[model samples]
Target: MWIVFDLCVEGADGCEGLAIDSTLDHPDAMWVYSQGNWTHSTFATGDPFVYVQLQEYGNVVEEIDSDSLVVRFGFVKNMPTVINSDLEISFGLPENDVVSLKIYDIQGRVIRQILKNKTLNAGYHSFSWSLFDASGEHVPSGIYFIELKALRSGQREVKKLLVVR
Candidate 1:
């Protein structure tokens, strides 16, 4: 699913407001508009920022002074439902490179290293976890974050997973 929000500020008249819009495609796709443009910020599993272009039509001579404008886009992935005890998260890269997948607790402590500096192929890949700590002990039911870092592209992706008894 895709969602977007737009906030417009008129420098000419000192007007400011917000506009919201969203769209969804059948099966598994979505599109959202922000600041009079479509955003692709949440396209697919590991896609980057969405491209957008803005155009304004007005006479420059009418303005008394310089004005400023700003735009922002954000999105999230709806992870599939999985048993907390059998929770396993995985993603693939576009090229063969070193990737790291780490699990961190709410206290910002490194609980386990699911994947560590492993060279992977360019395509879809995944990893599974049994929700256990480094010492082969089951952790308490709570929230956790899985961090994916790619060295080649210098990209970092984070996904949240839940564990319940």
Candidate 2:
């Protein structure tokens, strides 16, 4: 799974100061810091595209099988109505794309961003949520929604979740 993150590099002619500062070699933090320059006709023609290839750099810690589920809008909707603790969400991706999974309140406010701008393989994938808000505090018992969206593929899925004490 490779994701292409681009910087327009558009600015003044003397933009030699523009550079991509990468501190960590990890795939998740491939490009930590980046400086932009001018990429238009004034500075240059055609923006330079960077296709970053995602690589696995650790031992297999844990794995779960989720082959039975199907991809609906780049995700599945199978979830528990009421839960005592964590929630498991299962979904499938047809192809490699930038995926983001977020928990939203009933009023359509983002509660927690579980996954953001992560490169996921094309297959069944699962994520466990601790039902906590952005501040790491446990959410109140109520209704929430899981929004699975693929930015590149333009796919989105919204499913409801009920948390109870």
Candidate 3:
């Protein structure tokens, strides 16, 4: 499950894989045991900023030697789906990647490009979008679809937002 995020780091020069040893400056010791493509580890405290090497492919196809990858366990939650003002789209990333947020009409046509190819890091992040379309004019009150796509892995999650004027 953890590997699904790609775990691409920002800048840890010459990193090959996960590690924790006496040489590391981190006080809270950490360890990750891997079997082929899957890994198992534990996090007791503090923000985890570790880098590892990966050969990205498929939706996350990027050839690399070492990437500064730091990740934290996270999820996305939107509040007040039934909205009168702006709608909040809140999500937490496990690593650095391009994220997209869009709204589509009932007919499945994109009405607004709230966010396009925005880069973000791990931990929680949120943005508020009022009920409007690309034209900047307010959209009519009805049911709309909010789409969140992680560009790196091509992973997607959707939610329905109801706007009431």
Best TM-score among the predictions, by candidate number: 2
Q: What lDDT tens digits, residue by residue, belong to model 2 across residues 1-165?
A: 633344334452432232222223332322321333223222222333333222322234446666554554545654777887988888888777899999999888998999999998888789899878999899998889888998899989888778887
Clashes of 1: 0
TM-score, per-candidate, Cα-based? 0.50, 0.54, 0.53
lDDT of each residue in 108-162, candidate 1, tens digit only = 8889998788877655565777889898999888778778887777778877667
The CA lDDT at 8 in model 1 is: 39
Better of 1 and 2 by TM-score: 2
- What is the Cα-based lDDT of residue 98 in candidate 1? 84
Please tell me which model should have the higher TM-score, number 2 or number 3.
Answer: 2
Candidate 3, residues 23-108: lDDT per residue as tens digits?
Answer: 23454455542222334345545555655454432135565644455443333563676888977778767777788988998899
Shift of residue 39 alpha carbon in model 3, Å: 50
Q: What is the lDDT of candidate 3?
A: 0.67
Measured over all alpha carbons after superposition, the RMSD of each candidate to the real structure, in angstroms, is 15.7, 16.8, 13.3
